[model samples]
Target: MIQTFAFYLFAVFTIASGAITIMARNPVHSVLWLILAFFNAAGLMVLVGAEFIAMLLVIVYVGAVAVLFLFVVMMLDIDFAELRAGFIKNFPLGMALALVLLAELVLGIGAYRAGALELGVPDGTAMAPVGESNIEAIGALMYGRYLFLFEAAGIILLVAMVGAIVLTHRPRTDVRGQNIAKQIARRPDEATVNVKPEIGKGVSL
Candidate 1:
């Protein structure tokens, strides 16, 4: 009873927050609503005994994804009023796309319920003991079966990072950038200037 109640509570909060995320006029407020939705979704995952997924949702999605959205909204010089002015103009097109998506989702669910989808569970007969950690199992599968895909994803992310850096990189002609090679190759005598002063009384200018 407690579990069911908690599930419903989280589900309700998740749906409400999701609605707020889409309907909010302010971008920052929308991001906040999305973060709230992520939190409630994480709670729902926890209710289902998927602690790993719950933690991932909170740590990765909420912490990283939602925070990234918040940062983007904060940093960008967007005219919200001007953007909202076109909302009515785009409402019909947006509503049509939304309805199409809703129809697709409903059809997918109907197909799934009609046994058109074949979902498979892993064979646990030859698995470890019940007391064994799930992390070990996940690690084994990740490193064994999905190693190539994992490495590919890492490389893709690496390329994306380099591309982002290259895209945002601008050379400023006003300020001189450091020359590491020249600095490393420089001698003390080349860098230091010695001034010689005559040790005399200040009698004449």
Candidate 2:
């Protein structure tokens, strides 16, 4: 009973927050709602015995993705009123698309409940023990089975990083960039000066 109640609680919160994420006028508030949805989704995953997925959802999705969204929304200078005006203009089309998506989801759920779209599981297979470590299993799969895909993802992330750097690169006319050759070849004499004191007053002291 307690487990069912908890499941319902998490489910309700997840759905509500997901809706708020899309419907909120403020981008920052939307990001916050998205984070809340992530948290509840993680809880739901935990309840369903997928603790590894739950951890990933909380640690990776919520900690990194949601936080990145919050930071981006907070830092960017966006005119909410202008965005709202544009949204108002496109409201009918957007509403139609949303309704279509909702109908599809409802149909999908109904089909799933009717056993029309059942997934197959291996015979005699069972879930791993609760105390069994996920990191080992994940590492083995990542390094052994999906090594190529992992490397491809790494390359994609590297390219994205390089692109971000290129986008943010700006040439400043006022400030000069360092010249490595000039710095390496610089003479101490050119950089230093010998000072001579005036004779008369110093001698008296």
Global Cα lDDT for candidate 2: 0.89
User: Can you write out model 1's per-residue Cα lDDT over 51-141, one digit (the tens) per residue?
Assistant: 7788889999999999999999999999988888899889999999999999999999999999998788878754645675566666676
Clashing pairs in 2: none
TM-scores of all predicted structures: 0.77, 0.71
Q: Any runs in candidate 2 off by more than 4 Å, and if so which?
A: 106-120, 123-131, 167-170, 180-205
Candidate 1 worst ten-residue window by lDDT: 196-205
Error of 1 at 101 (Å): 1.2
lDDT of each: 0.88, 0.89
Candidate 1 ranges with C-alpha deviation above 4 Å: 113-117, 120-129, 179-205
How many times do residue backbones clash in model 1?
A: 0
lDDT of 2 by residue, 72-176 (tens): 889999998999999999999999999999999999999999999988876633333356666666766679778999999999999999999999998998997
CA shift of 188, model 1, Å: 12
